[model samples]
Target chain A: MMTLKKIAVPVAALILFGLFWEFLVWVNGWPNYKMASPSDLWPAFWKFRWLFLDYGWDTLWRTVAGLLIAVVVGVLLGMVMGFSRTMRDALYPLLVGFNAIPKATVVPIIALMFVGQHDMNTILIAFLISFFPIAVSVSIGLSTLEPEYRDILAALGASKLTIFWKIALPKTLPEFFGALKVAVTLAFIGTNLMEIVEPHGRGLGHLFDSGKISADYPLMFAVLIALAVMGILLYYIVVALEHVFAGWAERTPQ
Target chain B: MTDLIDIKGVRHAYKTASGPLPVLDGLDVAVPEGGFAAVVGPSGCGKSTLTRLIAGLMMPDAGEVLLQGKPVTGPRATVGMAFQNPVLLEWRTILQNVMLPLEIVPTKMSKAQQEERARSLLALVGLEGFEDKRPSELSGGMRQRASLCRAIVHKPEVLILDEPFGALDAFTREDLWQTMHRVKAEEPFTGVLITHDLRESIFLADQVVVLSGRPARTQYVMDIPGKGPRDLEELYTPEAAERLNILRQQIRIAQGRAAA
Candidate 1:
């Protein structure tokens, strides 16, 4: 019953939002080219459903693959930076400089360097954009760990590796999940940026670009709705994982 | 019995931007095997630094700390510690927290045996049913109990408690003191308790070592004169009162508020 209410509330709000958008468009008497109503989206989706599915799958896979690579590389780098003060000092400025560069600007450069390899460029951009949050969150989580916890393990003659496995990793899970949630959204933005910038005739971003070129505004809106739904789906997946792994961190009603 | 923990002429200072700030100055303390010594002083008297030195978590600059006659050059598995914060891992259940040291220290017990040991200690501390509960679910006093179990679960030769009960309410603190006695009866390790509570020092330790003000050194030692089970009522008795009085005066002297 509780779970049902939890799912039902946001879903009802979404329906209300759709109705509001439809009402605004109708009141203004805007042409579909100016602003597509919710009513126009269904037909556009039905007409191009197969293509949307194919393109959506391509985009989804790229985001997922990039995020997976980010998790592996980000965690290792974060651990190194978190464990050693010298390494953190050395790497932090570089990481901040890289992250500060707008990922949108990097897409053209990536296109220039790896010309015509659209999928890899999208994946690379996604990985680069997403990994920074994960690394920063993990390092902050590790460095701020309570000293007494380390003292307890150290007094036991536990090795640094053992302390990481037994304490640091579990302690950092909540923060890591927070970063993963942020990284997932960033990953999607990265993937879409590459597809829109290069327009290699693949992924949902490419489909959206095609819609814009043909003046199919409703189709473009439908593709956008598709992207939002995908982002929401991945976000919930991460939330579910957080519940499974770091549920203790969040206080539940007794 | 020989001393299980020995600190002789230990001096340490923390180097700051201004200069070297001394903490422990030529401190000396010892606790015989299975003995409990409570050290009390003014707040910043380096009592905690002494605990760390005894646990081998840090080294003193000028003197040596020994455990079982061996110089403590680095951290050793034979020393266990509990702090005022009761810093139990939130990710672990009460039972897993107790079993942490065993996982780190070299041990011959199989997994089942380790679980059994932790379960027994939890029961001893009146936390039997709370074995599977996460650290956050328990109250502060209960979490401190779990922390105590974790410290001694490895059966270390020395247990250094740096004000483990300092944060608890009076009732809870007294209850835990009783629990401490019960645990010591069964587990039997040398203990150094650094606390400000005079009654707690009297109730828990065989000897109370008083350190002088900052740049603390051992200035006085008072041995409680009985060797059997003690009642909390004894704390109000004339004999215990005299001991408490002497210790209070010693603390005053240590703080530079009274004549020596």
Candidate 2:
């Protein structure tokens, strides 16, 4: 029953939000081209559902591929920074400066370099934009390890590698998952930015651009709704993974 | 019985931005095989530094630490330690935490044997049904019990308790003291307990060592009468009261409040 309430509440809120948007459009007498109401979206959505799926899958796979690469590289770099004071001091400022650049601006430059390579550009952008948060979180997790825990293991004649695997890795899982959640959203943004900037006729961004050119506002709104649904779905997947790997960290006694 | 742990004229200091801050000077401690010694001193007088030296986590600048007639050059697998915080890994259940040292210490026991040993230790400490519970699920006393189980699960030659019950309530601390006796009887290891509680020292240890103020040295040693599964009731006797009074007086002198 409690689980049902948790699922039902957000879904009911979504329905209410759709109704409010529909009411506002109807009350203002907005044309379908000016703004697509909930009524206008369903037929258009039904008409192009298959296309939406294809393009959405394209975008989703690119984001996922980039995120996988980011996880590997980010974790390695984070471990390095976490363990070595000299490397941390050397790399920290460069990472901050790189993260500060507008990824949107970088997307165009990436497009210029990898002309017509839509998938590669999208994946690279997603990777570049998303890895920073994961790396930073992982480094922070490793560096803040409690001294007492280290001493406990060290007293047992445990080597540094043993301590890393036995203590540091498990201790850092919660933070890793936290950064992954944020990175998932950022990966989507990076992929979408590249798709829209290049308009390679392959992903949801291309479909949305096609809708704009034909003045089909309903189709555009359908694409926006699809993206939102996809984002929410992906975020929940990360949340589920977090529960599996770090469930012990989440428990609170009654 | 020979001394299992010996620290001879050990001295150490920490290098700070200002200069070298001396913590221990001419410090000496010893614990015979299967004997427990409790070290009590004023805070910041290097009681902990002395534990680290014996455990080989750090080397003393000027003196030697020996275990079983061998000088400790680095951490050996035979010294087990518990701190005030318990320090059980949050991700591991009580059983897994107890079995951690077994995983790292190169034990000949098979996996099943290890689990059995850990289970028996947990049962000895009154945590039989709590094997699968996480550290946070247990109360402070229960968690400390689990920590003790973890510390001695591998049957180390020496066990160090660095104020393991300092954060516990008075009743829980007393309960844990009894538990300590129970654990020591079942799994005999030369033990060193660092605590500030006078009653705790007298109740749990065969001998209590007191240290003076900073740049600390051994100030006094008092041997408690009668050991082997001590009852808490023994703490109320007139002899117990005299021991407590002498310890309090020694502590006062250690704190520089009373002249020796």
Candidate 3:
């Protein structure tokens, strides 16, 4: 299919870039400890595949759990804010102030709060990163109903609850998916950052930290590759969902 | 035979930055049961405001709008409306969009009955095969047609259209006019249309009420002279052209007054 061709271009380009990178290292006679070649990383990955998989699964579960909770809470808050001007006025400033704080700075505090539970710390980090986009996107989506559509519903004698279910929820779906895509990537990054700072969690970040401590450049490179693969996979999962919900929307005049 | 709608000395104004600017000034009109009427005027003449009032979407400051012998209070399900934009829910398929009113009505109809009614309406609009297609997949004219189907699917006693075909191309507009005429002929609901197109008013409406500019009031009420089943060819007649020219002049005068 044409879509496959489009995807193939970027994938082929990435493979070529990896080959070019390996060629550059080889030609320059760079030390393996300084910059590991793709060939070196591949052997290292094979040796540590099971260990990498366990870490990846742990981080993945934490991110997924955190993202789900954020979506549920964020959507409810957003709906309340969107439908009630009083609620928005009361809470929006507080939310903005909270969002303004540097999320990275909270990792240490979160770790301290959670103490020994690595899963709890990771979840907190992911939630902090993912919540903002979902809330903001849902609020915007709820507010962006066409005036005529609103008027039509109002004129039809639709109750507030009916309007929310039939109009608001359906209209907000595409936007929610868009926000979800961003949140998923952020969730991954947030979980990884939490791992990096703590260095005790079972995650790619812990793997990378161990590699650095042992001067294992090839292992670190392999972990970075795995992280890239995971990010792409998670992002595509959101994309697939967007396609399901919004496939009807894309046929409009662009 | 009581009037289906009575707009009695309705006055409305908006609080603008400048001051309270009046829009509708003691306007009054009566529409008989099952009558097809059109309100035509220049852009600022508040024709849309009148439709909104009749549909009970807004209240007049100084007067009352009566629907079926009751004073219009708020939006009522008995009144169906369509706008220039199709305003179809992008997420719903054509059948689902048509079935929307059924869902919101609070009267529990069996799902089978709703689907049957939706299909009947879609068939009426010549969209039987397009029941599963999304609004985004339809053409502008097709979408408007679907909107028309949606508006009437619930079988409301009154239907209000605000420039329903204004966004379509000339050929498509003419085609839809015929479609509308046929639908109106088949189902005898009290239909009120607000439009700037003079020919459209004459071709479709039983009575065309022309309005003066803002603070708008009814300037002229002309009876469109046509018997059973008119077509696009009627638009080419001298009578149609004369009516159109008269409307154009009245709109110009109204525009001049608004400017002054």
Candidate 4:
């Protein structure tokens, strides 16, 4: 299990980075308000573990709900666009225009429109951020199938629905999971950003903002570490699912 | 003999930027029921295009393709096809891939019956043990065999193959040729194969039709005479060699025309 080949340098570099952070805190005699050492942040995390967990759970649920909606809607629309050239030509420009809009800039406006409801604002933000990649990736993946496959399906006298279900869906699974991986990370980011602008009753983004205002550097560092862990956990969930469904995507052609 | 599939003075051309570039120039061919026919020509000679026409994937600009005395307006399940590349659905198991046509076609059989038919077809193609394996998990030759199973699962009146074994290694290709011969002998469906391999055409086809290059035309059609379905031993025979030489000469002429 210990594959040491080529990983030593990166591991060493990470260790060096930890030492540099510790060295910077010690040498500069930085005020606790400005920077928290590992010792301070560790204890702060333990003290507020339950509060952090509640906020993390709220944020996590909002992200997942919004992402699920986005994925369902995006993939359906993308399939329509992929199957019909006229629809693609008609809708793709609008999609491109929408994607170009700064989603974060509109977060406050969306919060106002939704009447400052925490769940609604967070969902809208996540939905906006997560939908584009799924749509684009699904369309591209569906359209890029080999021509010979199309000919085979046609020769079989396969109905349009049969072709879509049997060929297009399975062929697009790897790309769909790939796009989901990207979309999930974006969903997390969008949720947190929304919480910052429109602070919910309880959430990690609200916690981070509060730490900033109160000069709670140790608490802030703990929240930052928690955010990193959350992102990794979410990403790995999608990665694991990808492995289960489209494991052949990873195999190099022999 | 009545033709199961007929191509009558089929003139096909594509509208290019320069103008209409002709592919098939007034080509006429016919496959009687239970006939094994091969179309052999040089590469780029539109042999595959002719197969496409017969399969109803594309329509000729002039004339018509008839299946069972009916003009082919679009694809029909009664006509099955295989390509050089075994275009199996990567996600489905071999059994599921073979079951595809049954699911698509409007059939009276129950799901269990459909599945049984698919299994039998797979077994017929010498893929008895590969029912659960995905197309990606199978070897190239194995995938082609699965493709054959899928093609014939619906029990089509005519099976069209466009160099289905061209991508395999030599050993695998030869082995598949025998497998194909055995399958044909057992089922007795009309087969139309488009291949560049002269020996493959002679070994598998009851009659081989040689095409002229580019704007392809049926230049020659030779009957393959033997007592039964051809085997590898037939390739070494003087009769097979004479037929192969004649086909080779036709291909050389086709290539010369294409170059010109």
The C-alpha TM-scores of every prediction are: 0.97, 0.96, 0.91, 0.89
lDDT of 2 by residue, B1-260 (tens): 45888888988999999999999998888888888999999999999888898889999899888898889999988988999999999988999999999988988999999999999999999999999998988899999999999899988999999999999999999999999999888888899999989999999999999999999999999987675899989999999998988999998998999644
**lDDT per prediction?**
0.92, 0.91, 0.85, 0.85
Clashing residue pairs, candidate 1? Answer: none
Clashes of each: 0, 0, 0, 0
True contacts kept of each: 0.98, 0.93, 0.83, 0.74
Q: List candidate 2 stretches off by more than 4 Å.
A: none
Name the docking class for model 3.
medium
- Model 3 misplaced stretches (Cα beyond 4 Å): A1-11, A84-100, A251-254, B16-19, B106-110, B225-227, B257-260
Give the TM-score of chain A in candidate 3. Answer: 0.93
Estimate, for each residue in A1-254, the C-alpha lDDT of model 1 and write its tens digit.
Answer: 99999999999999999999999999999999999999999999999999999999999999999999999889988988988899999999999999999999998999899999988999999999999999999999999998898999998888888888888999999999999999999999999999988856499999999998999999999999999999999999999999999988998877
For residue B259, model 4's alpha carbon misses the true position, in angstroms, by: 13
DockQ of each: 0.88, 0.87, 0.71, 0.63
Cα lDDT, model 3, residue A64: 92
lDDT of 2 by residue, A30-142 (tens): 99988889999899889998999899999999999999999998999999999999999999999999999999889989999989999999999999999999999999999
Candidate 1 i-RMS: 0.8
Ranking by lDDT: 1, 2, 3, 4
